[model samples]
Target: MTRTHVSLQQNFAGIVLTQGDPGYDDAREIFNAMIDRRPAVIAQCRTVEDVKAALAYGQREGLDIAVRSGGHSVAGASVIDGGLVVDLRLMNEVSVDTDARTATVAGGATWADVDRACQPHGLATVGGRVSSTGVAGLTLGGGSGWFERKFGLASDALISVDLVTADGREVTASAEENPDLFWALHGGGGNFGVATRFVFALQPLPVTAFALLLWLPETARTLLRTYRDMVDRGLPLDLGGGMAYLTGPPLPFVPDELQGRRLIGMIATYAGSEAEMRSAIAPLLALNPVASMIAELPYTEIQSALDDPPGFRNYWSAQHLAALSDEAIDVFIAQGEAMLVPSPSQHLILPWGGAVADHAENWPQPHRSAAWVVHPFGLWEDPADDDYVISWARNAVAGLQPYSTGAVYLNFIGNEGEDRIVSGFGRDNYDRLTRVKAEYDPANVFRLNHNIKPWTP
Candidate 1:
């Protein structure tokens, strides 16, 4: 091993890996199979001190640095070629203060860790749609989840964040301390610093219900219209979910013939019992579903119900819409029809508003004001089909451009361009975030994410 590699291992409190070392290949594996990178060093951090040591060694050696938790970035921002990766998987932990109605989660912890801890206490905060998603990455990008319509984004539930800056200085951001940095953390992503821990305000959630209803692909247009009309008429804040066109999963409720067949589906989550949930979604229920699964299960069970298996080549994009016109609905259906069937892809229309819009002005994600979001999530196994899948996802968003709010949710998309990054946060909020970036990460040491460059005079 080189002297530089030895030095980093000496200083770090956790394991370090180089090429050919045991577990090096496994450590580099991430959610998106399309991303294949070989970093020079991988630091498996176990503590905040290890994070500092890893950052110092990477900077001292002039190596590009990437921070990884769940390694779920479809853009593969968490790994770099011939650089250093600060892997935080060993740091996963969650501490709950039930009396305070809060959860302090380690940066490396997945939403599963948070949900499992909070579920026992009948408490929870908003979290990622996929249980395997990292807490820091999702919250930093303005977290979206099933509970958002009721409790707002996961970032909105943050009480404070403990971070280690680029220069290895430790600091805390909250409403009472470093408030500017705290404000920027709402949706600024990983541009500012490496978050070590997050304290989130939790709400009591004694009961929860989930329902998955599916119909033939031919019913998409009618189903879409009925879904839109129901949202337009004002659904309860306690109701949350989305509509999708996807290959049906091999579940008990799904017919054998339809298991791998393309179908139109609707998923609903209610913060109350199954009876209340049935009442809330009576309109869509009246449409007659071919397959259905409705149950009052633990919140953790519902969080992982839709978890997609990893190692699939993945590509996704989204468009926020102020309104879903009938013409736009036709475009959505057309795009869904064109998707590669017998795959894990989904063309989805998720509802917003409710608590999402109620807290719109409080954060940088102005897209929260959008009434609907069209997300094309592409996941397939064959590399030969890459072009076809990617084109379908892009075209799905393009067709709805006329009704788009011109803003985006960064977490829902891969690296599109710098312009899309700026649009993720509005111009004014982006400007403000740049100033904050200038203060905490002026040298731009953490630029792997949807970057916010430091302000220049």
Candidate 2:
């Protein structure tokens, strides 16, 4: 029942929660524990009309507006202190359009919602590796997952978006309709408007494949060689996976001898028949894993394998590379040796070539030229060891600057600042994005994100 864009502040019809409201603080917070903001008013939008009223109200009242879906932006772009936050957390609705082979996802829905909805039908759309991640932020920012190697990404699979413009009018952007907006949203991050619902193409998800993991004992060289070959000839399109260098944890399952030692682990996914899956991963399995945990499980279970519990302690950082060169392997080993800790934190080099790399020029993504995504993530619950956690993250991220391609995945970025956002789009991609943002949001109403500056007139 939502109509096109029109200023409707005078007829605003929604809950405008002020600072004194009991739920105000909860409304402005995001998944990242580090971010803390106090929006002057948080609008709990139950419908598109509620969103319109909130936007129109913000514009007319001379206040900035921030739209929050999952509230998971690493840049913490979803909310602002003393501004207006249009919260769509209550709008999580999943509808499967089986005939169209598409799923209509509400803005507030997370990957968990989508995955749970589609898994029963043996169909899945591209989603983030983390199930709790919101569909809106991840999708708009270019969703990547274990399946990305075979299925492309969430952004490329976008079919349409129902959005509310600056003045509160609703519109739909799609490839055949608003092509420019479509391209921008594909990887440009949020700029056009508040997308309330997203339609995505879905594909069949396999019941299981061979998931493999072998620990590397200071074996960076051998691991890198195997990685290069794996990426060159991926396990299987059905078997989207990666092998990683790791520092062993003291989990009861890990032999006490290898615990707390530098080891390599292969986090693999074989999306095919068991026999084929086992054969596809045979090369890496042949590498002699200290301990192996490979099995034929359901797709939904594997997708949720690394699901971190809520209220988890998380610290993540990443770099982009055009190629994982031999010289780079030296750097990887040297840095891993220095930065590796006795804890569970793992350093990862996720292969980035294949369909992810075979893009035409000017695809609107700055990291397009990059060949792989390297993420070194840490997790711990001890508040007393905050220094140790921060130190580990900094050392690992700092040493890899030389081999990195400029820019990064917005999802993997930390509190590095506005500068990192500019870097995420690459110098050139940022320029074009700024222009696109200016075309639609001239006043910068959507400034509370990995912001694209309003274009200079």
Candidate 3:
């Protein structure tokens, strides 16, 4: 072992994994199977002191540091080759306050951890559609989720965040403390510091409904139009979900003939009873779905139903639309038809107007003003299909450029370029976020993410 590695092992109060270590390979695995990186050290931290020591060690040795929570970064920013990774997975602890209607989640905790803890109390906060995503990563990147229309973005529900800064200082950001840092944390990504914990005000979730309705590709255009009309005619904020083009899973609810085939589908979540959901979505139901399933399940159960398993080659991109014009709908439908069949790709268009637009000015994600988000999520297994799948997602975004609002949701995309980063958070917000980066991480110690270079004025 190198002198620095030996020193870290001796001084660091965490499980320091080096090359050839027993759990090193497994510890390096992230949600994206495509990312193969070997960090010089993987510090599996179990306490805040361990995080501080790891940060100081990396800085002292000039090793690039990657802060990992659930390790769900599509770009694989959570792990770095020949560097140090502060793996916070061991710090996954959550405490829910039933009386205060709030949840305090450790940085490494996943949405599943948060939801399972809150479910028993019949309370929930906005979280990513898939439960495996990290609470800190998703929330800081302007979390978009199943109940965003009703609860606002996950960052919107954030009551406070505790973080360890680049210079080894522990701090907290909230409305009353470090307010500027708090504002930048919303949708700014992991550009400032290593978030250790987050506090969120939860909402009552007494009755929840989950539904998935499927139809053949031949019905794509028809169902899309009906779905668009349903959203336009004032769908309630309590109803959330989207339409997508995906390979039909072999679920019992899916027709035997349709399993493994490409299909157009709608997945819906309602913050109400199954009967109310049936009434609310009656218009789409009247169109005669080929295969479907609806259940009055617990909120936690439905939240995890769509969790994408790891070990798949993944590429994704998103475009925010000013409005879903019929012309844009045609472009979206045509792209869905051109997608790689029998793959796990999804050409999605989700409504974003209710609580999202309502609270747009509360944070820096200007794209929330958009009426819809077109996300083309590409997931396949073969490395040979990587180029094809990436091109498909890129072309999906290009096709709708004419209707795009010129802003994006960073979490839905991989590392496209700096221009796309600027486009994600408008140029102005990007400028402001840099100033915050300058304060907490002037040397840009945390540069693995959608990095914001420290601003000097």
Q: How far is each candidate from the true structure, as Cα RMSD in Å? A: 0.8, 4.3, 1.0
Model 2: per-residue Cα lDDT over 186-223, one tens digit each: 77666778989999998877466646466665565787
lDDT for model 2: 0.73
In model 3, the number of clashes is 0
TM-score of each: 0.99, 0.88, 0.99
Measured by TM-score, how close is model 2 to the native structure?
0.88
**For model 1, how does the per-residue alpha-carbon lDDT over 6-123 read when each residue is reduced to its tens digit?**
9988856899999999999999989999999999999999999999999999999999999998899999999999999999889999999988998999989999999999999999
Kindly report which residue stretches of model 1 are placed more than 4 angstroms away from their true locations once superposed: none
Candidate 2 Cα misplacement greater than 4 A, ranges: 1-29, 210-212, 233-235, 245-263, 338-344, 360-362, 382-388, 415-419
TM-score leaderboard ranking: 1, 3, 2
Candidate 1 RMSD to the real structure: 0.8
Worst 10 residues of 2 by lDDT: 1-10
lDDT (0 to 1) per candidate: 0.93, 0.73, 0.91
Clash count, predicted structure 1: 0
